[model samples]
Each structure stands twice: as C-alpha cells, then as structure tokens.
Target: MTQDPSRADMEAVAEQVFVALADPSRRSILAALASGGPATATDLANRLPITRQAIAKHLTLLTDAGLVTPEHGERRRVRFRLHSAPMQVAQQFLAAMARDWDSRLDALKDHLER
Candidate 1:
C-alpha cells in the first residue's frame, strides 16, 4: 500500500534517529547532555571516555539526525544541546506499529474463539 508523504517523511526522520542511536558513544553523549545539560565536545570528552575529536565527530552525526543542536556560547564555544523531537517521532512510530500488531492479534484471537 502507498504511504502518505508526511508519514514517509516522519519515517525517514525516525530512521535517522535510530541510526544515530545505534552507536554506543552517541548514546553516552546524549545521556551526558540529558543529565548535565548542554555541553561542548570537549566537555563531553571529559565526562565520557571518548576523545574530544571523537565526540566532535559524534556530535556532527547527532546534529544531522536532529538529536542535538549546537548553540554558540561564551567565547564562541559551540555547545550541543539535546533535541528530543526526532526521538519523540520515533517513539510515536513504534507505538503505531505496536498498535497495528495488537489489533491484528486481537482479531486472530476472536476468530479462533468463534
């Protein structure tokens, strides 16, 4: 069946979020931001075991995925802030799929009981 364009766009975003979250380092970076608020790559590197350069690389991917946004802070330091919209969209996508499966299972149960 054909999918709606909006649905397709959301699915694409959710896919990006999933891809970004697939990396453990990326997840740790996000967790650090969530717990400590916005921070630069150096700050994340200090908090986590990853190097500054590696954190910077992961931050780039996170920014592309809309999982994090960069803001210029004092001294022009770019701080990465966690953005939850893409993740929320992904959660909604999973919820929709789960609902679809639940309805199908319920229908099968009813049919078997008949």
Candidate 2:
C-alpha cells in the first residue's frame, strides 16, 4: 500500500508552492513552463521581455520552492520542468478553504431564517 504524506509535510510543501506562485514573475514562468515541457533560462527570457539574468533569478526562486526542477544537460545547461506535487497540494488547500466557507455561509443562512 502507498503511504500517505504527513500533515506537516503537506503544509510545508503547500507554503513553498504558495510563496512561489505569489510572485508575478514566477507565475508567468510557471505558465510558460506548463505550455512547453522544459526550457532553459535563455529560452524563457526570449519568450518574455525580461533579460536572461532576470529569468535565472526567478528560476532560482522556483527551484527553491519546489515548483520547478532543473535537469543537468551537456555543459550543465539547466532545463526547468514543472513539479506537479506542490501544485496539487496548493489546489487541495484552496478547495478545503472553499468548502469551509460554504459550510459557514450555510450555517449563517439557517440562523437568519430561524
């Protein structure tokens, strides 16, 4: 049987994922990465108006947050790909929050009608 991840592990990963997405540049990077499998810093920079250096900086943040993984190619050229695990965690958190809000709203409506 598969082992479930602990709550603390999920929370930590979710936090990192959220923090990475909180930045506009990083979000844009993720979007670009999602559209195309993996891209190098220069490739991403060419797609965006940003400089290669700026893309590198954003990539570092994304790597740290576990949103992206860099693969070492010949000459150590880094290619980034999306890490879906953290994204899933973030989605689950949002879904839970929405469900909680819905329950609270239903309770409020019931109280008002009574």
Candidate 3:
C-alpha cells in the first residue's frame, strides 16, 4: 500500500512550486506548455520570446519543482510535459490557509458586532 504524504512533505512541495512560480518567465513557460502541450526547449523558444538557453534554464527549475517532466522523444529530443501534482498540493495548502483565515476573520467580525 502507498502511504499518504505528510503535511511537511506537502508544504515542502508547495514551497518549491511557489518558488518556481515566482518568476514571470517560468510562469510564461508554464502557460505555453499548458496551451501548446508538451514541447522541447527549442520548441518553447520558438513559441515564446525567450531564448532557447533561457527556456532550458527555466525548464530545469520547473523540473526540479515537479512542475514538468522531461520525456525523451525521437532524435534524442527532450520534451517537457506539464505535471500538475505539485501544483495541486500548493492549491491545497493555499485552500487550508484560506480556511483558517476565514474562520478567524469570521470570529473577529462576530466579536466586533457584539
């Protein structure tokens, strides 16, 4: 049986996702992958204004963050495919934080209304 990830693990993954997403270039790369599907660094360069070297760098970071997976294609080409698991973990983290804040804020409003 597979064990579920601990909260710490989830937070760590979420942190990596957040750091990876902090860059506009990385975000653009992700958006391109989302719209165009899996693509090589050269393919991304062709689609985005970013250079091939820069896209390769951004792809490295995205791979490290578990945002994308590299697949070997014909002629030894590496195509990057979007991976949403880490992003989902980050979304869960944000949702949990929002829930906590919502409850606290509701309590504060109730206290002030009294």
Candidate 4:
C-alpha cells in the first residue's frame, strides 16, 4: 500500500518519539548513547544487562525513528549516536500543548475573577 506523506509529518515524528521512548530498555539505551557518545552494539550490550541482539533490535528501531544515527569508522566499526531532531520535535510539541493549557487556564481565571 502507498504511504501517506501527511501521515509521516512532524506529528508522526512525535508519535515515533513517544513509541521509541515507551520502552524502559530503549530509554536506557538512549541514555547510554547520549552520555557515553557513540558506541557499537557490543559496547552497549556490555554496558547494559541486555544482550547484543536485543540491543541491536532497539538500535534498529531508534534508527528507524530518527532517534539515532549509525556511522562506520575504521576497521568497519559501526557505532550509534543519538540524533536530537526527533526529540526536539517531540519537546516542541509538548511545549506547545503546555502553552495552550496555560492560556486556557488563564482565561478561566480571568473569567472567574470578572
């Protein structure tokens, strides 16, 4: 089936971010990458309790969601690094929603005061 471009917009990115972050292990993997910089799947596996295969699966999902990027270094070493774009998009969305709620609350407060 043909994909819908509109369905894959910023909102979709936000959705992907939420889905990717929903898993605790994935969150830990992301944190590891964020704090330690780029790391190979084996490195992450060693750091976390998760096995290499499990880490690889999470990395694949993260990569697909644009949360992480993979780079090939010398000796064919591939390491994954976090990408901020998707997270930033998700943060912007949450901020906008918070602002909307604040505006509505202020309006309600003013109406009650008047």
Best by lDDT: 3
Checking candidate 3 for backbone clashes, the offending pairs are: none
Question: Candidate 2: which stretches are off by over 4 Å?
Answer: 1-11
**TM-scores for all candidates?**
0.91, 0.81, 0.87, 0.82
Range of the 10 consecutive residues with the lowest summed lDDT in candidate 4: 2-11
Model 3, residue 96: what's the lDDT?
A: 81
Go through the candidates in order and give the clash count of each: 0, 0, 0, 0
Lowest summed lDDT across 10 adjacent residues in model 1 is found at 4-13
Better of 1 and 2 by TM-score: 1
Q: All models: lDDT?
A: 0.94, 0.87, 0.95, 0.92
Q: Write the per-residue lDDT of candidate 2 for residues 1-114, one digit (tens) a residue.
A: 543566557767788888888888888999999998899999999898788998999899889888899998988898999888888988887787689799999999999999
lDDT of 3 by residue, 1-114 (tens): 553568678878999999999999999999999999999999999999999999999999999999999999899999999999999999998898799799999999999999
TM-score ranking from best candidate downward: 1, 3, 4, 2
lDDT, candidate 2, residue 6?
A: 68
Error of 4 at 96 (Å): 0.5
TM-score of 3: 0.87
Candidate 4 C-alpha error for residue 20, in Å: 1.2
Ten-residue segment with the worst summed lDDT in candidate 3?
Answer: 1-10
| Residue 13 displacement in candidate 1 (angstroms) | 1.4
Compute the lDDT of residue 83 as modeled in candidate 1. Answer: 97
Which residue pairs clash within candidate 2?
none
